[model samples]
Target chain A: GEEVAQTPKHLVRGEGQKAKLYCAPIKGHSYVFWYQQVLKNEFKFLISFQNENVFDETGMPKERFSAKCLPNSPCSLEIQATKLEDSAVYFCASSQSTSGGHNEQFFGPGTRLTVL
Target chain B: AQSVSQHNHHVILSEAASLELGCNYSYGGTVNLFWYVQYPGQHLQLLLKYFSGDPLVKGIKGFEAEFIKSKFSFNLRKPSVQWSDTAEYFCAVRAISSGSARQLTFGSGTQLTVLP
Candidate 1:
């Protein structure tokens, strides 16, 4: 089975509207990660969490993007105000390493968001 | 900063031809490496991974890669290519023992277009 899962395979919103995406990490996995792929570029890291505690958010673009990992529910990434530049595919990944060891990260189907 | 690099940005080849995608990383210490493929309209899937043991690792769909510690490289390869093999290939890495080592450092990704 796929290790990570994401919801809302596709989404479209106005420039000023809000958009939210979800991710469910693999069972028993303690680390979750989010990435964004814009247009024809690479997948850029957004944030990462280790057991509900943020481990690193250095790649995250502040000012409108935020994410959270809660117990029993899928982690989420919310954008307050959509921008045309935000139209891209968002990928979520998970790993089982709590100590940041050599665990392989598993990726999800990803959600393609189109901001109009 | 730790990073992954893919030499070939776009590769086009005919069916039955040999395939090789170069990937390199810049990080000191033990690490886990992986090659992922994202087919058109499909999610990213792990093709193969290398942790320890032999440097040459094989992946699904007839893909394989070699881990060169000295050069910090993990390149994907295939003996005979197929049109179905056309997709985006990504190289990712994470240190085996380090803070946030579970987080992946991905490359810009290479677009492989196998012609039939």
Candidate 2:
């Protein structure tokens, strides 16, 4: 069964509008990651969180892109002022530590955003 | 910065044919390699992974990948592929020494279309 869940399978936003994406991590998973796939191919890392704290955000565009994972709430990725280039598929994934030392991340079905 | 490369941008094959996809990475340190598959309209799923020990690792759906340390390559292989296997394949690498341990660098994905 798919553990991770993403809302709004499809979104349409105009340029300069705010676009928000949501993701719910798998139960018991401690890590969350966000990625952007543009042109239906290349995947670019956006950000990652360990629990409610951010672990790494080097890939994020600090200007307009911001993401947050808060307790008792679904993780969210927001683009302040969307541009035509922001139209892409957003994927969320979750992972938890295990005895094997390597825990594989499981992904959500992704949200497709179309900025016009 | 570490990066991954998938040689084939797109691959088309008839059912029952053998399959191979090349993946190379540029990181001069211990790495964790992974092969992920995304079936049409489905979330990304782990096909196989390699951390250490054996150079060859087997995964679900008759998929296998061999990691060659000297060449910095991890190529996916299958003796026979089915039409249901049509999907996008991604190669990802995580450098163990990269301080930000959980960040994954993904390659431009290879889309595999298995014809019936």
| Model 2 root mean square deviation, Cα atoms | 1.7
For candidate 2, write residues B1-116 as lDDT tens digits.
89999999999999999999999999998889999998887878899999888999999989999999999999999999999999999999988773333777898999999999
Minimal lDDT window, size 10, model 1 chain A: A97-106
Error in Å for residue B110 of model 2 = 1.3
For the candidates in turn, chain A alone yields TM-scores of 0.94, 0.95
Question: Residue A43 deviation, candidate 2, in Å?
Answer: 1.2
Residue runs of model 1 more than 4 Å from their true location after superposition: A1-3, A98-100, B97-101
Question: DockQ, per-model, please?
Answer: 0.58, 0.57
Candidate 1 backbone collisions, by pair: none
Q: Return the top candidate by lDDT.
A: 2
DockQ of 1: 0.58
Task: Specify the highest-TM-score model's number.
Answer: 2
**lDDT, candidate 2, at B21:** 98
Error of 1 at B11 (Å): 1.0
